[model samples]
Target: MAGDDEFDRWISPIEMTLNTLTNKKVRGNSIVDIPEHLKKSNMKAYKPKVVSIGPLHRKSSRELLYMKEIKWQCMLSLLHRLNPTDDQKVVPPKRLKDCGEVILKYDEAVRACYMDPIELDRHELAQIMLVDGCFLLELLLITNDKQLNGEPKSKFPVKVSKREEFLSDLKLLENQIPLFIIDLLYLKLFGQKSEGIPNIINGYALYLFGCSSGRPIISPNRAHLLELTHWFLTSRQIEAKPDQERSAPETVVELTIDPPDHEHMESMDIWLRERDERDKKVSKETTPKLERCAARLQAAGVKIKTFYGKNRSSSKLEKDPVSVMFGCKEKFEQGVLEIQSLCITEETELQWRNFIAWEQTRSAEKTWEQTGTPATEKKFSQYALLFKGLVCCEYDIELLKSAKVLKVHDENKWSNEKVNKFIHDIAEGIQIDASADPKFCEMINDLNSCDKGCCRFIMFKHCCRILLTKARKFCRYLYRLLMRDYCSTPWQTLGVMAAVLLLFLTIAQTVLAAIAL
Candidate 1:
């Protein structure tokens, strides 16, 4: 009976552990730390320089400590904005309490959004979310107001450089709090539900990012600010035709925003499955081969041209910056390869690295069943690979520049050599499934076939020209030797002729003697 009691006590802890493990709910983690391998190449790109937002980097550096005070001030300002009729100049305690309660309610969901377990206690995490979320919302409001009115009315005067740094810091993957927290707090502050929250935030993001022309598609399902920005930058706006625009009612347009999560996921799954099927069909039909460097393509009679859309207007170029097209009026002749122009600036590398890092994280989180490939198909990574294959040397850069397909904002900062290296380095460590992009695969096939068909004739002509030139040079050298040494004068010329005749007779006499023997 003593041994039985001891065994039961020991088994109790094991049973409890098993229950805890089995009962824990699995949640999708949208925000993740940059992997160490990616960080080893460029750590500065991932770390926030101005401010830290979430619990991941709350107090990692003393530099971010100053932002905490600023954040509190932002919180107060936000409360004031929410209740302007209050005569008192101080922050209302009730408003602060309401915000805290809302954040605390959603604390578990917020924690689950992060890939790694956060060490901060529940109350501490809620406080951090409340403060950071308000700070970001207030900053966006102030920036938008300033941009629209051309006057800064906020007490916390954000300088232009400081505002740029804040925007950059907010877009960092680790410096994000979930968007739902901000949305919930915005609703609490307003004391009513409004659909304008996502629009307001997304619009401000576009304005700050210098992309005001983008469509501000409101999606409550977005994970965070960085994901929203990524979607805005990558999304294309399809213009309605004249007849469709006239026939379609305005109510149909509003249906595009804030779709149900399950419907969105189902539609996405169906689209991906269809795309994978098409890719398989295309791959089986013809194997696509990557073209050689840009210079080699040019040598093969492939004309590299800048694509300005079907209308030939530069305005439409921004709609799809990474699009590539290839066509020929005749087979193996008049071949033209068109690539959208890319403008490289000082911030280009930093922005591209961060975007790629986020994509890498998202790809890592997806299941094999969802993607149907080893890596998720990312258009930006495909664009990077296109440039990586195109730019191999300074001459290729010159070719692209002359064709108006590549532009450097500042030549002094981004020289040809630097641009070439940047193009090659940006796509490193990114896994690309070439068959995922059918248009890209088709372009590669056309370029390869054009290169092979035209290069053979071009190479044959080149070799023939070289051989003819060498033969002409040999004839000229023999003529000069004979003129200088033997045919300089009449008597010398006669002596040379007699010597040639004697040599010929000696050879004939030897042949006759050998025949007689």
Candidate 2:
């Protein structure tokens, strides 16, 4: 018995290791609560303002508890849309029971996707999935159906005013259901294949999420709402430029991180000294601080031109409003910077925060070597880098606005200062370890080169203007004194008298000379 006990103890650990390695919970985590550090930046952004879709925020408050009836109504309406006559005669509980049974089969897989364990039992979890999935299907269907028919329908119970807020809430990181659950429910309601009809929930999500710029390849391994949306936004396959055509920007700044070799160290020191001397020679001509860049560029005779996109198709133009707002058009070229006129609204912060959180989650799982792929290009990081690179202050914002690159809706009523605050807020907590994107780096290089290239000429012209303006101001002051209108004090009155006498004597001498001739 003693020998048997020792063997059992030794084998137990191996047995547990085998079990863990073969665990059914090997699926990657999809749904996660916002990390504490990210949440600390903006607690309200992670909170559901209008409605909660998933279990994390579903029963969070009494107010949210009241939304259960609305969810039930959405489910019933979804059934009616699927099969109108039969479902109308059926009671809501009976309909829910039928849907709940279908959800139960996949409940375990769904539960594993969440980062934290759900406290609910099997039946309760199934009910949450059915209700939430139906609500989402119905909401997306309303938007898409209206777009198809070119008119709003009364089939949906949500108010038009609340739609924007609800859509915004759906985007919250904590308030999300797995896409598979939504996809399964969609297939059960609508058949697997339908001629002339779009594919299930994913199609609507792609369209409504403003992914018309390009469609991402949807794989079965998709995680959750936030993950899917990020993929759609950033993972489109763009055609690569040829290697010969993709040379680095023509700028003096070094793009490399390596130290100079010992053989070149002395030459490098000599080059630096020469460069310093050259810069000092032109220091007075190039020393004006950059104020408004566009304004400064204009002063330096650089043209600021507006560039609308190439496509004039009205059909494509009307597709996605958000995609259109992003100005995701051409690459930034020399002498012109194209920017989409995007509005900064109250919901903008919430949307951006969720995007950053999703990116951070994606970034954590990424390895250094794996980042070379198109999938791990870190598009949100690209956005932050672009904003940080272009917008240093209110002056830069004004510069973009002057060039018609950025716009705000009159309804939102955002000022230039407010927009600056909005951009900085979005950029504050996000850390992009990667360097600026190659294209963005090229753009910055061009702008900086132009800045340096024009520095001497702009400063020389600026200094001359300053001296000329001061001289003109002095001449104006002298004319005002001589004219007698400015002669209020004793010194001014005497100066005005002397100036008037001199002018009269000059005029009289001229008249006498003319008579003698």
Candidate 3:
């Protein structure tokens, strides 16, 4: 009976959990805390700097307290903007109460979006969402308005650096409110029938991030700002066609010739088998492994080139950032490796690290059965790995720079070495499986083959050139030595020439005597 009681106690919790899971609303947890392994390497990348937006970092530090007043002011300004004709200068109490109520209504859904549980009560969580959502909306609106008017004005008293930092803080993985909270509040502010809320928010976001407005609007179902930005940056339009239409018809050929006898046929079969073995051996030798750095690739006849859009007028941001191609109709002796131009700046590390963090979080939550490996899904990581492989040293950075593939903003502050280290550090601690991306694997194989085809030739040519240069230097040194030691004056120069001529004459005479004998 005691054993039965123990088993029942253990089973009861599992049964209760199952019931809760089945009965509760289905919501995906999108906002996740950065894993300790990733955070340990670069905590600043994941943590918010200028302001804390959500409950996760509400109490992270006292420094965020100053932003609390700013949030309240932004919420009030947004409220005023909604009801501009109000007689009272101050925001009405009822309007503020309505915003809080709306946030409170979706409190449970908002909490479910985060991976970790919120310790704050319903009212506290609602207040955080209400204020933070308003602050973000107001900031976007202010920035958009300023840019549209062609004026450098500040609605808020924040400095340019602080404002930029605040913008960067909005992209942090942990510092995000649910996107629906913003949508809900925006709906409440403008009447419920206003269907353009998503367009408005997405447009403001695109404008704020300096992305082309022509980019497709992200579906409103995105989890947060970071995910929207991720989609905005990495998404591309792919033409879908039926497999039969896309694939070419297979071709087959049959060659027939009569053999003189069974013995001749056997001999032909033996020769064919030997030829097959030799071809396989040669293929194995021709295809080498991926080179470590871009300099080595350049040396092996791989031309590194930057890919702008198909047209010169198209915005670079309009093109997919992760796309890479290697084109060479002939042997790798002259192949062009094309990659989208990457601009590295001071905020690049912070922005990209958070993007990587979001990708890592999403990949962890989703199952690979739906998609393929994380490599195809986590494209930003693949792009980072591409640059990491290409930029291992200062010379590799210079090679990329000369190719116009990598642009470093403010070269005085961000040097080639800094960019090289930044590329190496961006994708640090992310584990990419061997079979992650098939296209990437194919590119690597092609690069290896190209390297194999021209590496030996490049090395031999380099060696020959070095030998020729050394021979020339030795001759110059000998001439200088003869000039200094024996040809200081005209008499000495004539005497040295006479001596050289006499030696040649003696050798000729000796050769003639031997021939006569």
Global lDDT of each candidate: 0.65, 0.58, 0.64
Stretches of candidate 1 off by over 4 Å are: 1-27, 85-89, 147-152, 155-157, 194-196, 213-216, 237-289, 310-334, 363-377, 452-517
Report clash pairs, candidate 2. Answer: none
Weakest lDDT window of 10 consecutive positions for candidate 3: 322-331
Residues 123-224 of candidate 2: C-alpha lDDT, one tens digit per residue: 888878888988887777766777678664435455668767767887887898866666566555554422111223445675566554222233322455
Q: What is the per-residue lDDT of model 3 for residues 217-267, given as tens digits with 9 covering 90 to 100?
A: 534234678877776566642222233111222432111112134554455
Candidate whose TM-score is highest: 1
Task: Spell out the clash pairs found in candidate 3.
Answer: none
Where in model 3 is the C-alpha error above 4 Å? Answer: 1-27, 87-89, 144-157, 192-196, 214-221, 237-291, 313-334, 364-376, 433-436, 455-517
Task: Estimate, for each residue in 120-194, the C-alpha lDDT of model 1 and write its tens digit.
Answer: 878999988989899887877776767867774474435566765667787788788877677677667763333
Q: Of the candidates shown, which would achieve the greatest lDDT relative to the real structure?
A: 1
Ranking by TM-score: 1, 3, 2
TM-score, per-candidate, Cα-based? 0.66, 0.61, 0.66
